[model samples]
Target: MTTSLSAAELANLVTAVPGVRGIEPGIGSTLRAIGSRIRQQDPRQARFGVVVEAGSHRAVIEIGIDGSRPVKEIVRDVQETIIRALSEAGEHDDASETRQDSDSSGVGNRNTPQVTVRVQSLL
Candidate 1:
């Protein structure tokens, strides 16, 4: 069996990363919500800027960040931390829970769930 991450769970994961001030609303999400409304569905709130796309057994996380930290470094750190969390969940038979190490770029480490981080603002 595989573990699935909820939007709230993902949000918590992102916020826990060091230097991450907060998750901003993704630019495209607003447009998507408007489009969905046209289809007669209630407008859904953006996933705290953390868009999660789940595949057969993994998830792709896209996050928007607002903070006064180095953009590249913060992004990489977030990716690594998220990947680690997912990996841990995959391991524990309890089927629950949740970084970036220097040796690896932490981009596509386990190739399980891919992460993309966008810097929206500084401080």
Candidate 2:
């Protein structure tokens, strides 16, 4: 089952990751727009940030982080986390349907949102 996550839900998920301070300015609204586009994912997944299409179910995320962590590592972690979240949401949304075995991540499904993380500042 494919599930949808809202901006608040996405934001919460992002914030839960270690080192994330908060979203950069103007980012919250961008996330909200993404969330609106995914209104069908899961109503319950509406507690955090949202996903939007930036050409192809893609979202660009701008974040502020703590300067203590290694920049490369933090970026990697964010990528993995968002991917995992999207995968889980997709699985949930497709829970009732039969699935095919493939190497593609869940986000690769039709119209699945892709996330872009931009570290605006290390505070």
Candidate 3:
């Protein structure tokens, strides 16, 4: 059976990766967090830099790196980690090289979620 990962869970996993400083909070995430707090909801439940677009089966992640390793290497690790996590979640593993840009990496067929990693800053 296939399972879906929440944005918060994905964020947690990304943050745990070595050399990952933290999620780079964007304006949307900040506003969502503030709104959640104002509405008496758990702020932690608010989406951070990781955004999972269910309709498109795409995961967009923005992160701040610790700069201990090469940026490209760190980005690749992040992409691979996310892909592994998604695969473990019962997502299909029809791997394909779908490069969206120089910094982003997307793998898998249409049955799997495409992961896009963006390095927002160096910490």
Clashes of each: 2, 26, 0
Cα error of candidate 2 at position 111, Å: 6.9
Residue 22's lDDT within candidate 2 is 80
Cα displacement (Å) at residue 67, model 2: 0.8
- Residue-level lDDT of model 1, residues 1-123, one tens digit each, is 133555567668788877787776556544554554577643222254655444433433445555556678788888887777766655563333322343765355553666667666566
lDDT of 2: 0.63
Find the 10 residues in a row with the least total lDDT in model 1.
93-102
lDDT of each: 0.58, 0.63, 0.71
Give Cα distance to truth, residue 67, candidate 3, Å.
Answer: 0.5
List the candidate numbers ranked by TM-score, top first.
3, 2, 1
TM for every model, in the order presented, reads 0.59, 0.64, 0.67
| Model 3 pairs in collision | none
Alpha carbon deviation, residue 105, candidate 2 (Å): 7.5
Model 3 per-residue lDDT tens digits across residues 1-123: 123566678888888888999999777666766676689964434576866555566677889999999998888888878777876774342234454454544443554657788888996
